[model samples]
Target: MLQVKHLLADKGNRIYSVAPDEPVLAAIRTMADHTIGALLVMRGEELVGIVSERDYARKVILKGRSSSDTPVQDIMTSPVISVNPADTVDTCMRLCTDSRVRHLPVVENGKVVGVVSIGDLVKAVISEQGAEIEHLQRYIAG
Candidate 1:
């Protein structure tokens, strides 16, 4: 069973965040600069919410709101669905499916450690399956 800690270890625990009061445009720019789909909205060391490209599209563009004037808190998804370091990859996948979210922040000891996307979980699953198949093939060869 692959855990989130293992994934974070491979990916590195680097977190990019935006302040809640920052303009949505700034947040979008940050995402663009990082080439990431989402950013964690933080208030100091506390994780408050998450803002993504989808949020910008639906909440800002579709709503005809000005991104420069609109704050990230206005568009960010709050009451975030987060995962623990010990959580299994399957658990994160299920949470993403059930919550209809693409990203999950990894929290341990009340601290945000890293973020994982659906793509990450899928990749991990594929790698795990490949390793399993290789092991089975080796067993059969012996």
Candidate 2:
């Protein structure tokens, strides 16, 4: 079972975050600069919520609100669904699918370690399947 740790090891664990009181426009700019879909909403080392492009499109743009005037807290998704490093890729996939969320913060011991996306889980699963297929082919040829 490929774990989140293995995925993080390959992709590099970097947690990008924004403050709750930060302007939504600035947060969106940071997300664009980083090429990330979401930002962890942090409050002094504590994970408060999450803000994503979906939030901006649905909450801000659709509502015709000014992004520069709105705070991240106003549009952030709270009670974030998180996973652990030890969790298997399959588990992560199920969580994301069931929750209808694209990103999940990896939390262990009440500390945020990294974040994983549905894409990451899918990639890991595909790689694992490819490796297994290669092994089976080698065994059959032997």
Q: Each prediction's TM-score against the native? A: 0.97, 0.97
Instruction: Give the poorly placed runs of model 2, Cα more than 4 Å off.
Output: none
Candidate 2 weakest ten by summed lDDT: 118-127
Q: Candidate 1, after superposition: displacement of residue 98 in Å?
A: 0.8
Tens digits of per-residue lDDT, candidate 1, 1-142, equal 9999999999988899999999999999999999999999999999999999999999999999999999999999998999999999999999999999999999999999999999999999999999999999999999
Any runs in candidate 1 off by more than 4 Å, and if so which?
Answer: none
lDDT per residue, candidate 2, 52-79, as tens digits?
9999999999999999999999999999
Error of 1 at 35 (Å): 0.6
lDDT of 1 at 117: 94
Once model 2 is optimally superposed onto the true structure by TM-score, how far is the C-alpha of residue 21 displaced, in angstroms? 0.5
Query: Which residue pairs clash within candidate 2?
Result: none
Clashes of each: 0, 0
